[model samples]
Target chain A: MHREDFPMLKKDIIYFDNGATTLKPQCVIDSVVEYMTNHTSNIHRGDYDAAVITNKLYDNVRNIVSSFVNCDSREVIYTSGATQSLNMVVFGYMKKHLKKGDEVLLNKAEHASNILPWIILSKQIGIVIKYVPLDNNYELTLENIKRCVTFKTKVISLAQITNVIGDVRDVYNIGKFCHENNILFNVDGAQSVPHMRVDFKNCYMDFLSFSGHKMCGPTGVGILVGRYELLEDMDPLCYGGGMNSYFEENGDYELKSIPTRFEAGTTPIAQVIGLGEAIKYLMKIGMDNIHEHEMKLKQYLLDKVKDIPNIIVYNTSSNSGIFAFNIDGVFAQDTSIYLNSYNIYVRAGNHCAKELKDEINIKNTVRVSMYFYNNYNDVDRLVDALRNSKDIFKIVL
Target chain B: MDNDLRREIIMDNYNDPMNKGLIDDNSYLKTRTSSESCIDDLSFMMKIENNIIEDIRFDGEACAISTSATSIMIRILIGKTVDEAKKILNNYKNMIEEKDYDKNLLGELAVYDSISKQPNRKNCALLPNRAINNMLEELNKKNN
Candidate 1:
């Protein structure tokens, strides 16, 4: 497919940093601009024709996301981003159920967004934070999780696919185990939801969170999917104008129904509407085809870089669209600088998971993440650049 | 003459860095600074004798720009008084910020003038100066 469909890719730039955020298609951008220019109105409040159209569009986006994830429309709660969605689950669920002396199980490979919030909550509530260690291949195993879980384990928060390494975990089995033990399961789907097929119903997950921007949608929008009954019992993260129904001088106040009850204050209406268009674009392309296209490019790059002496590739088993590696005897930032000279964009450093870096025994690595828009030609260009980098810069590698 | 000399200066210093290591514990004030965002670390040691900078040394893992910048900076600061060293550091910072820099005052440091063109690498080139300024701040705190 021609990249002209995405206006941002026309800048003579090779974009491989899709893990950070993907470039939005023209359709998604046009949807957002069209909404902002023409049908912009405050949803769920105003009574004019504009408000009616806005409400329908906003709620329709929710329905699109619900079908995308195979969940109920009422189960999806919109937030600022995945970070807020994660914090909502950690704080909202922990406040309702967990107490001092409870333990929340986590994996060593979790991003800071997934781990730090739970750590802060544990400190505040006096709950213990435990970790399930990754195997030698950087895969989280059921045996390791079973070993980590204790009788006091109240919650298990883990990434469905590690953001940096892109290793997929068996969240289905993990969720089943958590449910059997009466422990709440929270899956960080920020990386997985964009690249793979996620069925919340089949996975039996208690809570799953993902961001829109990573899926070729607009930023400032995310979805937290959970069971409707559970969401009804949990308190909203924020309380303000949109979430509450009736307020009085007394401390007691009545809150709105599910979804709206969880979403407080003003929403990212334009971005959400654009995200709905993004979903439609992805659906038209089909997730399975997108996944296959990225995997083929990833494998091609992996094969080409495998024989390059002194190059250490992280996560050889990752079928997802991310390649993390480092040139031996060269700082990752230096290598990234060399790549940037050729207009090839890649991410370097710890990738927001300092704990994962420690677990992997590397301070930082260069990451070349791919999207459906990327192809084998991009991979070959990266390889050619890598081969010529030392000779071009006259820097001994 | 200006552009060629600038590149030459930076390359020369990067190839052969001077005063690159730690000093004895009692010899001078020392501080360790690092860029966690980029994972760069440097340990800087300065030896002061009677209010004069007798010597300066740095040892750490960093990009070429930072390593070379430290090498050239120590060469300029050595044998200068404390106030003079501070002035030179300020001038070099201004040079990296694309200010009107004096070539005669910069000496070998003139080679780094082109670094201003690459704004992101400016932090790497200025790492040593940041440590020096931070060290001066600590010394001032002690004196006050």
Candidate 2:
């Protein structure tokens, strides 16, 4: 499995919290270290050899990102993280174009970043917010989307794969529907881009956002891929030295072109280069192979944990490598703490998708997310830890 | 459990928690507190008459350590005057933090003798006691 690539795995623990952030490989680390050690100069500013090399490596990440998502390099916008990317779209595009009485459609399964920005905008302007209905399993179906759409529906924003529930959403079909109906479509690709292959043109997405850290890249680097025509129409969220073409004393300034204008201050040069290396590493392994490995692990884990006596599984139909569940009488946090004592790490709480609390009818649950590095032995260790936890909880109660 | 402190007294209180319910009376002083890192949501209510804590109750969703700590705390607080309650609270905090304190004075709270070793659970064990300390301050202000 590519477990040896991550140095932190030497510590005795079964890491099942990959949905929060992934462990970076040695090649990605080396890329960042190489840049910092040798070519530690500003890009696009100096005429020296170091600066030229820096600029080339920095600009090359755009091509890497574009090819990773199957979009043109000019459409790839560098950002601090997915949060910043989503905010740019919210403040830069939606705030300007979406008017009062217009509607924005979302669902309960979306991450907080996707929903909160729209909520703030809806309150600021008198824009109405609506939700796509869900079935018994809290899944957003295509029929539900059609049923929820209104004449005033102007935008549809959702996650490619929800973090908590781990359901693989058919965003491509949804994007096609949005195009035919003349509505803007935005995809939160933070969870999906790291796990599976995503094609920008095939999905017909107007805008997509994702973080690099969740895909074995550095923490501060991410990408926002937008159609060139739409990106040209939107304004920049920040103004600074690098993004400007010319300036006058009377506050008059000519700004740079689309992607450059959107990236305001000093960019994350080392992290972006590291992300380019990460994208190459992922492509070399093949996204299909990674996806298949993850599914096998997921199936193995589910089959083993399903018959556990007091375990209550919340997401039975999830296609992704995330499992959300809890023991009958034990609190989610307590269970996670118990497992932690056995050198197993998992996430507990509402998992930042607090809006889904009422729908799921539980305030908290434990989440175990897996990645390509995780294998069946890790699953066995977790199952054994969970089984032993019951005996300990009896006395600790 | 590997640790005796987690096994014996903490577990005893968690399994059969005392003073856990809602007091609907208007005379009770009520407050709520929660921790962000874990599920430690709690609601506290105390009935104080004549500067004495006649009754105290807690109700919430929390982990074993937090729930058990609050349960053990309410048992030690009932029927004690505000001043005595404050003294016990300080002593119990000292005991859990492994500072020198009169072990006999802490009573059932001395069960947390080895809590200092588990640094992360210190907040879990002290949250409700801290809430009660706040309640005591509010009562003192009212009396003043």
Candidate 3:
């Protein structure tokens, strides 16, 4: 692949922070810039030619995203980001569906974005929130889920791939269980959608949310894919001009259809169009190829760091892009600083999954997340830098 | 990589931290705090007898600046009166905040004077001092 496709990568920088947000491809950027500069218009509103073009482009991107996740366009709803999508599901659904004494089952390995919304909702409504403990390897097992679920269980929210440990769960099996028990299954796909292939139809999930920036697109755009019937039943999160069809003088208003009902006024049209271009780019490269490339880099890094004594590697089962580890005696932040001196960038905190660190009994671990753009040479450079700074970056036993 | 930002003593102490364990007895007051964003936790213990700090110990996991700052703090705080310790804590805070700190009084803390240059790590270096001040406040509240 041509590295020039991504203008951000041209700057002598080895960005290993893809898990935070990915570098936008030139195709995606051009798509966004074209829309912003030339064809800019309020979508689904004005009757002008520009507005018509804008509406088609916006809806086409929605169709593209729906196809990317193997769902219908009606199933895809745009939000500010994955966090907003998650909050929309938790708050929007719980307010309408969950009754007092209902239970929400969650995994201990969930990101704060996935967990905190449910936690807050549980506090607001009288729903009981319970956690399914991970096994020795930080994997959420069916057995654990069975132990955690009860008759009062109304929903099960989990991360498809843990941001910190890269532990991928069996969302299909979990979805099966939830469906069998009449529970709503919500999957946080922020970390998984970028590096892995996700088929909503095959997964049998009721709801799934993913951010665009994590998948080589621009920020401020995310998708929440939910079952058509379920989304129709759930109330809209935000009330606004775009979402309402007609309003009577006596406070009576008809809401727009699904997807638009959820999307409030002024959607991120340009970014969503750019996200479509991003999805097209990924489709050309193939998600499986991206997965294979990332796995190769992950294995290369693991192999290089394995022989180094006093180095702690987290999540060896990571088939995806995330690699979480710590130098034996060195603090994660210090190790990150030392690596930064070499122009290699890796996230060194809990990666916004605060509960996972405590659940895994780690204070902090350095995380090096891979992307399709990263190659073996990048891994080699990282290994060389780590090897050279063993004394400064190693933790004392 | 700025010369003024890098602390040689802080790095040395981080590599080889001193007084890095919990005090066994309950004679000392203990305060624990952690940075949720960075996931670094720190615990401070001051063994005070007759209103004088006899010994100090720290136990936690943190960055180089934090570990080294704690080590340097415990080393300097031993055998000082409570009032004197508060004065030293204030001086250390001022130094990290780039305020006009008395050069002669802040002896070993001068090693960390460059900490002002690295703004992000400034909180890590001041964790121990914050814990001490918080502990003193709690002690005063209890006495009242």
Interface RMSD of each: 4.1, 2.4, 5.4
Please give, for residues A27-138, the per-residue lDDT of candidate 2 as tens digits.
9999999999999988678999999999998999899988889999999999988988999998899999999999999988788899999999989998888988667887
Give the docking tier of candidate 1: acceptable
Q: Chain A only: give the TM-score of model 1.
A: 0.97
Tens-place lDDT per residue, model 1, A1-397, is 5477998778877899999999999999999988888889988889998889888989999899988989999999988888999998888877677899998888777889998998898778888998888898887888899998888988888889887888888988988888889988888999988888888988889899999999999999999998887887888878898999989998888999988998888899998998899888988888888888888988898889876777789888977888899887667888888888888899887787778865888867889998988877788889988877655334311
Error of 2 at B6 (Å): 5.8
State the TM-score for model 1. Answer: 0.91
Q: C-alpha displacement of B71 in model 1, angstroms?
A: 4.2
Q: Estimated TM-score per prediction?
A: 0.91, 0.92, 0.88
**Top candidate, metric TM-score:** 2
Candidate 2 docking category? Answer: acceptable
Leading candidate by DockQ: 2
- Give lDDT per model, in order: 0.84, 0.87, 0.83
Q: Residue A265 in model 3: shift from native, Å?
A: 2.8
Tell me the tens digit of each residue's lDDT in model 3 across A1-397: 4467888888877889888989988899899999988889998878999889888988998788888889988899999889999988988876788988999888767889888888787778778888888888887888899998877888888889888888778888888888888888899999998887898878788899999999888899999999998998888878987999999999998999998999888998888998888999998889888888888889888888887777788788856778888877677888887887788998888777777865789857898988989888888898888777755632211
Q: Which candidate number has the best lDDT?
A: 2
